[model samples]
Target: MAQQETDERVSDEFIDDTKDSAEREQAHRERGTVRPITVVGHPMLHRECRDVTAFDEALASLIDDMFASQRAAEGVGLAANQIGVDLKVFVYDCPDDDGVRHVGAVCNPVLDELPPDGRVLDDNNEGCLSVPGAYAELPRPDYAVVRGQDATGRPVTVRGTGYFARCLQHETDHLYGHLYLERLSKRERKKALTMMAENTPRYETVPNAE
Candidate 1:
């Protein structure tokens, strides 16, 4: 996920960060090896990922690699397919509108339906690590909740509002074979692609095979 720069950060009094979450994120990064991010034209990015049925050391290593990749790309969130893994998994270290940081990995994530009161939309500039240097304004619910399991197979629920909510939705979309570019109009999609072509990404990327 791309970070938006705004002078006014959303102030939510209820937002809080936990020590366990922070420690877990750090541990993953320390153990992870950075991998190259896949670009837009890669076939792996276009297919729905397989559900994660195993919660073993491999899954744990994948999560660690995801965090490492995300940080290397300077992104807030990343899906498995972004690094050539075809599994329903994503990792995030995103900050909410209030600037409260949240970190965790979700497996086989299922996004919950929003209630009537929580349907507020925030049309903010959204970008993807796969898409690289391009960004387009996309409207998404300001609040979101995702249910899934942790690396250890323990059930976990993640909720966020504002920027973090956008990260949850964006990363979940990637797992489902969807990209933020698909949500844009034809002209806007082209515009984003053009921008991508003009700007060289700062990080290494895995190019699609010819």
Candidate 2:
């Protein structure tokens, strides 16, 4: 659902195009990079991501690929695992309820403190890039302010209110071992699973992590 090609890859094997990580970075910087999305049920989707220790070219390239993929899929945000990387990073270009755009990436993020009154998801429902074709009324804080380092190890903060808030929560959850489905109640979870079964398998075939 996301990406797997350097905008200039213009050929098959975009995912296999790189001989190594350095080449991948070069390809990404030259143009947009789109990595194939890791579908639901992929082991990485259920595991906590590793912290990003190296604020280097590789990290920046990965972020670029994420943005390219998110745009290709027409998604609002994307996390590392969603594209088969297990690093704590995510990118977004989501809009608030007022249509103001918010775009950037964050690594090793910590969500802001919620309002003392607690919070809930918007009535519009929520979805995930990994769990394609499925969405449910998942409750999450209605606002968010995430803080972390950028790919270059620079301090960064992202704030959101309204739908952008949901995007922040959703992407952060991906860095953990949680998907939107896990946010649903037992009954709702069952319903969502059934709906996905009636559609194309998120991954044409299940992925093996080990």
Candidate 3:
């Protein structure tokens, strides 16, 4: 898969040791615009999110909030459940390996394919805002196509390859209450559990607090 174009860091308050670490940290501190990302063990993260059946002002507002929350958390994409909503909705501003931008909001999404059923990854590890401080080698298709509606109920189909594809599938999994950890082998799952057990909360509120 191609690399993802992201400036948003997954971990909360990470000190980027790049050339402008100080500048980046200062900006993040000033922004303070993040939403509470949900973590594993939250009941909502274990249940399938409901399909978005209502397209109204509330839906629009929710999408906006998710966008804000996602940017605040420095994420490439985010699902409604990630912010603690039960609706099957997600938003993204990610990129393909070639650095082309692909962005959108998808509600009530259906995947065109799934892992163990498509092209697989062996070397790449995936992270979750929900499963903070944990990284696991979870295989997913290198390409992804997701079909759903926009906030206004207009039909939308999105196709992505590389990191963008991975973003789509990851957010879709959140809609179904499936963490990347679920895709891990038993040994990896055990290690992820250990990581979660040793970590602290990433945000002030539960991811589902909304």
Candidate 4:
């Protein structure tokens, strides 16, 4: 009977802790403002992000701003460089084929420290908000092991396969001055460029009669 009472007390405490945390996070979101999304031609998107040292209030505030911007833009992932910040961090929330949700943010992510023994696959429709109206076929390892921190500075190591792995690698690549289009094959690159050119509008003038 005593053991049962102890378990009940522990469960109650856990619930209270979770509720408090959620409330605090919501309040933080309310207090923070979202940053603007940077486009492809921006120099920051092509530059590597710096490692985060001293995860203090500034880092926490940046993460909150990123989350807000991501939600506002409705993107699956966003990097710090995407918003002109040079911090090595990104957010992701992708849905599976069956509509299940997997969402999280990773700060100072390190990837592929392990051997790339996993199979590589082609995802032909990768798109980035920064690269507007652009889609390319990028080759990616179907599985990867990533290590990083969560929003609250807790260490997290995740081993993912399939689309989840693709998302992880894609965001991590953004931190390192790489875009998915850079991973396309030579033929695919030509095709993508042609497509981009065709989509671009050219100003033309009508011939005048003498």
Better of 2 and 4 by TM-score: 2
lDDT of 3 by residue, 68-153 (tens): 77767777788987777788899886777787666568787777756565666645778888877778876667888777777787
* lDDT by candidate, in order shown: 0.85, 0.72, 0.72, 0.64
TM-score ranking from best to worst?
Answer: 1, 2, 3, 4
Model 2 TM-score on a 0 to 1 scale: 0.79
Using lDDT as the yardstick, the better of models 3 and 4 is 3
C-alpha TM-scores of all predictions: 0.89, 0.79, 0.77, 0.71
Candidate 1 lDDT tens digits, 1-210: 211133221122332334566787788898999999999999998888888878999999999999888888999999999999999999999989887789888887777778878599999999988888999999999999877767876666788899999999999999999999999999999999998999999898998842
Task: Show how many residue pairs clash in every candidate, following the order shown.
Answer: 0, 7, 2, 0
Clash list (residue pairs), candidate 2: 3-34, 3-35, 3-36, 4-34, 4-35, 5-34, 121-140
Compared with the true structure, the alpha-carbon lDDT of candidate 4 equals 0.64
How displaced is residue 95 in candidate 2, in Å? Answer: 0.8
Model 1 weakest lDDT span, ten residues long: 2-11
For model 2, the superposed segments whose C-alpha errors exceed 4 Å read 1-30, 118-121, 201-210
- For model 4, residues 1-210, the per-residue Cα lDDT tens digits are 011123211211111112244354455456667776765556776778887655688887887777667666666677888777888888765554445455566777777444555466746477676654557867677776666665655565555566666777888988988877678788876776566546631211111111
lDDT of 3 at 16: 14
What is the C-alpha lDDT profile of model 2 across 122-167, one tens digit per residue?
Answer: 6668877677677788766777877776667766667777898899
